[model samples]
Target: MVHTFSGNPLDREDAGRRDDVWIDTARDDDSTRFLALADLNVPIEGESLHWLHREHFDESDLESALLLGSEEGAARFVVDLSNESASADRYVDARSAATFLSMEDAGVVAHARSLVDWHRRNRFCGRCASPLIPKRGGNVLQCGQCEANLFPRTDPVAIMVIVDGDRCLLGQSSGRMARSNFYSALAGFIDQGESIEEAVRREVMEEGGVRVGDVRYHSSQPWPFPSSLMIGCHGLAETTEISIDEKEMNDVRWFSREEVLAALAEESDVLRIPGRMAIAHHLIHDWATGTIEV
Candidate 1:
């Protein structure tokens, strides 16, 4: 199943965006629409996104706006209004905004947020510490002195639920989840030269102190808190001993099918899990509900 931030419908004009003339024309086009984001927050009106026109911004603003994509032959771009004094009420945090936004809109906003944030953070070249200029409609950052090109990157994270018989392993991380009393599937970033299956097994062992075997891929989600691709999986546990990593986790334990079901339904006071917005929810729900067996 495609997750919340995975179904962007806009046509990311890859070839056309490479041309400087085409980008200028599109930015000047009357039909072009720009999504204005302030402090990485998205603008919302009622139940939908509040898109602004090109005329609302000056030439300097339009110059830095990143071309997101096109819909129905009209150009679409995203501009960061972090420096401007925008009304706070009209904007909502991207994480909270996704709950009310349409799946397609959420995907577009995810793309915009990640792209704009990357540009904001990568203004200088890493190789030579020179200023990097935007190219290919802000998709590529080119270093002027070194003549090197850099592109935005999405980090991969492995999130999995390890199962043994009728019970599944879940963990509460050290800080936020510990305070809120929420448990989620153990997750960690994929390391360099590490395969997804290897990462899953390693992470399970490290965080939950349970050895995992026979990993299976389930689904993936685009997490745009500065851009991450969450790879979800299900695994069979070879051991059930709990020795939670004190530095990383507050608690890690195995819960029965009944416990997880009640938690998914929001009927359990002792256990709480993330909502549908997270892929971890699907991983746990699918396994506990017998939708997928490990």
Candidate 2:
């Protein structure tokens, strides 16, 4: 199934992008399409990206445009319009845009946002504090002084629904969801030298004080909120004790299959989980409805 940002239809010509000649030609080509982002907000019209031509942007602006991929032999690029003032209504944040965009369009936007944001944040070398230059169609960032090659990094986060008999473990973080009933799958970044199962067990134990014995892979989603690959999983709980880490979570509890079903159907005021846009929703729905055996 094509999740929100999972099915990007771009042909990221890996070998072709490495050649400067082809990259330069594509940048100036009249047929090349560009998607603009102002402060990471996508420009949209009638639920579609407002694509611009090469002529619309200055030569300097085109130099920094990231090569998203190729479509029908035409290069698709994304450029940041943060310096240029635009109408607020014409643009929407990537998260909100995903709600209305097609799977392919949302994938493109996610790709653009993650790559552009990476470039914006890593303008300088981490080792030498020197300026970094974009290379290989903006895929690689080479430092001028230190000559360090940096690539875009995607953080792996383990999100799982821990099962305990007829109940599943879910939590609300200490921010926006703290005041609401919205609870999602327990998640945390996979450590530098940790496996997906290890991360799932660690996160569940840390957040909800639950001991997980068996872990099974569910699915993965490209969550581009500053570039994160959410590794979804299902875990079998060995213990059913609740101990909330007050700093990280507002509340963590086990919800029954009946209650979860009610919430998923929007008939329960006591609990609410994420919609189809999130991998957590699928994880919860599948378990509650017996779509998967954990």
Candidate 3:
């Protein structure tokens, strides 16, 4: 199941190092290797930043390079001189790159991108009005004043595929692209003091106006668009009637397994389900394949 999606597994041996690692974005040295995310259709160049593993290369083995960030608050990742043979001139967005890279490679890149984005956004200390510095090999942020340490945060979100018998509940968000009738599971952020089960029930009720029972955790994924951990679940539908919150969703409906498979295979730009890169797609696929029983 994990291997079905992109950015699932990463070789963490090098990233597990406890030393403060550097990401070089400069072009002068030719010894470093760079993975071009833009080639895969990610909209921004180096917009996502998070480190997965660190490799110990001698300072002399690699040349010092500058990290470049976008004017709109993008961080500069490591520069690779070894990628000189590759076309560095081309810039592919991260979204497209996720499709291009092998699932393992995409996962690594997503981790690094998420970490870097965290560092950039959390530049100031929350406890004190002091500037924070990177520590713990870029994993921890320390405030110069008061000596406070901060860690990266992954927001927990609950996403569920609600099932009754031969049908599952799906909703279309109001913010969806034009001409899109595609729907997946209902999802929402988990509020504080709410258990995952509670979240599943609450989100289902709030978004689709349906009561859910027997909520069970199915799988989880690190969604690093801006640091989110998607908690996937399967919820037994206690009520089939759906009353969607018009402000949040455009429409809600129940889909049969056959209908879902059709949507999954649908290639039209208009009638498409979530991409395979997303856990939503996995949840649907799993349900369709009987891997996740309601």
Candidate 4:
């Protein structure tokens, strides 16, 4: 149950796979809408979310564009205006942009950001170091020098809620923007060929020296910081003592349910977890409500 962009109901028809009339018709049709991005900054109109129509800009202004999908007989596209800095009315962080947008709007913006970032980073073929062209309606890149089609990739990460008796393990990463000691669930990227469950167990063991006994799958979230699929889970820990990985986290400790509940019920100076927008927050919320235990 990825909360962000995954639940999209739109039909993302592959431009390479089908010969649908709508695909061609969408390009010229007035219903075709465009979400413009300039250096990863999404355009926000007033209060409600809005996208630019093809009428809004000259064709030359579009540095790159991708066919996102279609909904309700209309096609939606995302264009990177990173080459055109003058188009932005006011620049805003794309991550913060998704925070208050409507579900449908947020979903599209998230997809747009992910695709644009993929395209931006992969301008050249890894094999030949030659320029790559957009293919499959911008879902993939192809090298003209060689017949290779490179596709967008999403990294898989495991985020866990680990419990030992009445206490839960949470950590504050040194990589965080602030050192206010706001803690969240332990997370790590899944190694190649590793299952989500294995990743959860290994990450917990490595980061906090907590041997996980039971691992249960929870809901997931699409964290589109670049692109990552967060697999959420609940873990029962066999060991209570923590051995902090100083390199990975600034602080690691076990907090009782009472302590977490207090923070969840109200804002506090001592601790803060991620907000409602993150799956980590939901994982902590569920634990606070006695939804899961060791």
lDDT of 1 by residue, 27-51 (tens): 9999999998999999998877888
Clashing pairs in 4: none
Worst 10-residue lDDT window, candidate 4: 15-24
Q: How many backbone clashes does candidate 4 have?
A: 0
What lDDT tens digits, residue by residue, belong to model 3 across residues 87-192? 3444554556666666765665566556656766887889888999765435678899988998778899999999899888888888845237777778999999
Where model 4 places Cα greater than 4 Å from the true spot, the runs are 15-17, 20-24, 61-63, 86-89, 177-179, 292-294
Listed per candidate, the RMSD to the true structure in angstroms reads: 1.2, 1.3, 7.7, 2.2
Q: Candidates' lDDT values, in order?
A: 0.92, 0.92, 0.65, 0.79
Instruction: Please state the error at residue 285 of candidate 3 in Å.
Output: 1.9
Over 1-294, each residue of candidate 4 has an lDDT whose tens digit, in order, gives: 457555655678765224535445666689888877878778888643457777877765433558888888687778878776535466567668767766666677677788899988988888999999876667878998996999888999999989887888998888854478589999999999998889999999889888998899888877778889889999998888889888888877898888898788766667788877788988988888877553
CA error at residue 58 for candidate 2, angstroms = 0.7
Cα error of candidate 1 at position 279, Å = 0.7
TM-score of 1: 0.97
Q: Ten-residue segment with the worst summed lDDT in candidate 1? A: 85-94
Give all TM-scores, in the order shown: 0.97, 0.97, 0.75, 0.92
